[model samples]
Target: MEPLDWNKHYDLANLPKFDMTLCWNCKAPATKVCSGCKETRYCTSECQKAHWKKHKAHCKMFGQMHMMGELPKIMKKNEPKYKGPSMGRCSGCNVRFTPNYPPNDKCPECGYTACESCVVHEVRGTCHCTNHNFGRTYCIMEPRWYHKNGKTGEPYIGDRHPEDPLHEYTPDMYEPVERQCNNCKKITKVFKKEYWNPQRFNTSWF
Candidate 1:
């Protein structure tokens, strides 16, 4: 039987890049890229083998993106202007910090940190360690439909700072909260103020 493809199964989108040219296990200059995913690089086979346990999940994810023709898009590095704070790095993924969109997830062990896809429980849970918190600092709030201009009452559509104001939206509005699904009637933890759209519920709550 074939292994599960979570991207397809979960309708996942906006995958991350594994295209760094340095050794994934150590930050040495590398010439060898993982044959399996053609994304991660390693200085030697030893480094590849050493990193396999941790890289396994990311390797599989990148390989899946390749099979689905999504690899090119991820590897392109078309990042938008930085909208988040100047957090140095993510102790979890070791990548530079980026925006957490909204309802940012703060690492339980340390305060006000965000990680790659911190919104996901499985990913978020592994973000803290003995030495330091793997999550970065919360920088900005992503615009949401519920955020209305104070005077115009129109939906605000831009990155928001903590001090910024929209009469209808609060910084904590997207923080995870429990809500009852209108369609299934099952209570689930959702980003606060998020609406349920049955068709897109599996992928997002906008």
Candidate 2:
């Protein structure tokens, strides 16, 4: 059998630049590449030794790939953008499933989609609105819906009057306020300032 040309498999462009890459052990600029893998770089032998336990499995895998005459294929093919009606890997646990598995919740901040199991068990929390006379405790998960000012698009913290069906609330009266976590009862204080306003109002609950 012809020997496999492993040299062709190494994608050097995909490897992180050695000068900019930091040592896994010390977070310092790496000065030397691992002799076995030629991938992970370290500043000193001490850092390499300190990182050995964590690097051993990766080292072995690289060694196996080298022996197999396969250049490291680290660049993954870009996955097609997810449309509705299909399943994908859960960002939380890295498990891939089909529609049999429940729908995933996408994070507004990072755009990571986690499975329903993770959302329910790991993400769901109770938030308390102290402005309410009874102090309303409500269950909240990722992608929370909030009432934002129509003109400024900034979220307002004031409670809407129950009898005011027309929603006659003024912007000045909607001052920002601290809200508590109903489960832990921890208060998070924020300045009454608008950082980035949402362009569109959230109509999911409406």
Candidate 3:
């Protein structure tokens, strides 16, 4: 049997220069190649100079990996190992379900997932999902939904889903506030629940 090429299975192993040819800086079609690595591409000299500060470490590491001839092995090693079952498990209830089962509610930020029942029960009316009993947990909701108010400079709820618990409340009246977690007694940022979108709830509850 022929030896398997692990590089074919790894994403990072396929550098953008070989595929898309996008400039590492401006993301434009790049023709000029990095003299040192010959792998990184740049659209212009200025873009290359500007990106050097950030790309320097990566270029150096790439050179080392290339010289060692272990890039494929390294890429394979770094590939994420998903420990979750093929049938997804709920982050809250830890229930396993078939692949065809209704989609689980997933955290936009961290990609944490929980079944519909556990999500509703744990989140309550607040837009926070309880994971571990840690101090001052981060809000799992999409951060873009919160924006700074013009006058106050405080973060306030922006556009809300149709079924949001506080959808009727305008952004001017209510501001995003901090609340203490009941289990850990730690101050955490909480928002009004957006029921329709990601938080799938039973229809009869309405």
Better of 2 and 3 by TM-score: 3
lDDT of 2 by residue, 1-206 (tens): 12223446557456333343878678788888788976677889999998888787667656764555543343233545433222377655667867788545653322445576755542221111222211222222112233332123343343232223544334443335656533335464322223112222244423
Order by lDDT, highest first:
3, 1, 2
Residue 176, candidate 3: how far off, in angstroms?
97
Predicted structure with the largest TM-score when compared to the true one: 1
**Clash-forming residue pairs, model 1:** 114-136
TM-score of each: 0.27, 0.24, 0.25
Model 3 Cα lDDT, one tens digit per residue, 10-91: 4556543444388878888998988776667899999999988777766765565565676688888998854332337765
Q: Give the TM-score of candidate 2.
A: 0.24
**Each prediction's whole-model lDDT (CA):** 0.48, 0.46, 0.49
lDDT of each residue in 1-206, candidate 1, tens digit only: 12344556454464433437678788789989888987778999999999887778777776766666864676566766333333565433445654543334554543334553643433333333322223321123233333332123343332222223643443454445555533233464333434321232322533
Candidate with the greatest lDDT versus the true structure: 3
Question: In angstroms, how far off is 73's CA in candidate 3?
Answer: 18
Q: Which regions of candidate 1 fall more than 4 Å away from where they truly are?
A: 1-14, 17-19, 70-206
- True-vs-predicted CA distance for residue 139, candidate 3, Å: 83
